[model samples]
Target: MLKIKNLHASIDDNGVLKSILKGINLEIKAGEVHAIMGPNGSGKSTLASVVAGKEEFEVTKGTVLFNDEDIEDLAAEERAHKGIFLSFQYPVEIPGVSVTNFMKTAINETRKAKGLEEMPAKEMLKLIREKSELLEIDRKFLSRSLNEGFSGGEKKRNEIFQMAMLEPKLAILDETDSGLDIDALRIVANGVNKLKSKDNAVLVITHYQRLLEYIVPDFVHVLLDGRIVKSGGKELAHELEEKGYDWIKEEVNA
Candidate 1:
């Protein structure tokens, strides 16, 4: 459902171009979960942001194809409207906008883009309640400003709740396990597992294997120095956990 061919990206102005993704080649099929693990500055988050069309980064080369269309040229909102959902590592707080209002606007905008009729308020509210319940979020949480005054766990749960509501085709979760305790991790993983379907895919970018034990990816890849140096099955995560990334670095430099 998603493909990246020889993808390369850089940051800052043209003068400060330092390529973070060096010829990345990846494919994520529907009904699958792919995990990307890497050390600090390995470009895991940069890849996610570039795929989501974040404006700060620039693609120096290569292409990103969503479905059959090339999405490298699309704007971030356009990519989102096309069933691309990104759960940021740092959830942004909107001080005045209630979560309910924010979600409603996002859902409606997506629907309108797909030529679907707007959902009646009652129907939307019902769906939101059901999803919120599944995430164990109180209705009052919906009335609060988005991420404002929310604990770290609360922010992550809220991200999953929004994902459940949007139901995007491809969900890119960037460091979803960061700052989460075991209980909160289980809750978040359960929500993601429940949302998985035959027609959707998830790309989980994490620094550790702990989250993989819960969410269980179909494939695992190790990225180093801005490129994927190794790709393997779920067991690769176990190996990394046991031996650490130094083994991989040794192998790379061998």
Candidate 2:
């Protein structure tokens, strides 16, 4: 459902344009989970942000297409309206806004963008309850302020909860496994797996293979120095886990 072609991007660092993503070519069809594994500064998150239309980075070359349409010029909000959901590495907490209320507003706004009316209160409440239960979230947790003072696990789970409610066609999870305990990681991955469908896709960007154990990927890609250096199936994750990225780096240099 998403295609990126020779995508080149750079970020301004202290007034100097430093390249990050250099000629990244990837295609993710519907009903597939693609895992991007790389070391620090390999441009994994950069790919996610550029795809989601973050303006901080400049796309000097290449194109990003969603459902066969060019999205390079689309703003971040517009991309989101087109069913692109990005789970941030560090989710910001909005104080004074309860999670329930925040989700209500967000869903309504997305509906409005699609020329639809506000969801009925009853339907919204029902969806909230159902999705919360799907994520094994306590109802009382929904009443807490959005992400405010939440532990790392809670924040990540909340991100997935929002994903469930929004039901985006393409969900890009950037470093979602960071800071999560084994149990928290399982719960989050389980929620993601339950929500996956033949009509949607997931792109998981992570540093380690542990997350892949729960959210098994259809494809495993190793990104290095702003480019995807290798691509393989799920077994690649185990290989990387046992050998670490050093072998991959050696292969790249060789």
Candidate 3:
């Protein structure tokens, strides 16, 4: 449901722009899961941010199309409203906002954007209960402030819970497995797998292949030096795990 072509993005460093993503071309159709595996500073997350419309990165070239429309000019919130959800590597802490309260506001705001009335209190409550239970999130946990004092697993699980509630067409998970324990990873991956459907797509960006053991990707792409130098099937991830990115770099440079 998402297509990116020849995307080049850069971040400004004290008034000078430093290039990050260079010539990234990818297509994620509905009902597929795609993984982006890369080493440090390879612009894996940059592609996710650019597609999510993060303002810090400027897209100097190429186009990002969601479904069939160009969203390169849209703001982050606008892209979110259009069914693009990005799970951050580091989810920010909101001191006083309970998870339940935050979800209520987000859902209603999206509804408002679609010219629909607020969800009835009863329906909203049902949704919260269902999604929390789907992600195995405790109701008591939901009562706590969002991401405040949460363990790495709790934070990542909470992000998946949010994704469950939002039900985006394309879900971009940017290093959700970072710092998560094995059990936590399993839980988060289970939640993501359960949420997968023929109507939605998932893009997982990570440095390790372990996460793929759970939420298996239909395709894997290797990003090197800000460009996707190689694209292959799920087996490619295993190859990368066995042989580091050096071999891919060599192949690309050859």
Alpha-carbon TM-score of each model against the true structure: 0.98, 0.98, 0.99
Weakest ten-residue segment in model 1 by summed lDDT: 12-21
How well is each residue in 1-254 modelled by candidate 2, as lDDT tens digits? 99999999999999999999999999999999999999998999999999999999999999999999999889998899899999999999999999999999999998998999999999999999999998899999999999999999999999999999999999999999998999889999999999999999999999899999999999999999999999999999999999999999999999
Cα lDDT listed for each candidate: 0.95, 0.95, 0.94
Error of 1 at 102 (Å): 0.3
lDDT tens digits by residue: candidate 3, 114-228: 9999999999899999998888888999999999999988999999999999999999999999989998899899999999999999999999999999999999999999989
Q: What is the lDDT, from 0 to 100, of the residue 95 in candidate 1?
A: 98
Error of 2 at 169 (Å): 0.6
List residue ranges in candidate 2 displaced over 4 A. none
User: What C-alpha lDDT, on a 0 to 100 scale, does residue 47 get in candidate 1?
Assistant: 95
Which 10 consecutive residues of model 3 have the lowest summed lDDT?
Answer: 45-54
Residues 1-254, candidate 1: write the lDDT tens digits: 99999999999856877778998999999999999999999999999999999989989899999998999889999999989999989999999999999999999988898899998999999999999998999999999999999999999999999999999999999999998999999999999999999999999999999999999999999999988999999999999999999999999999
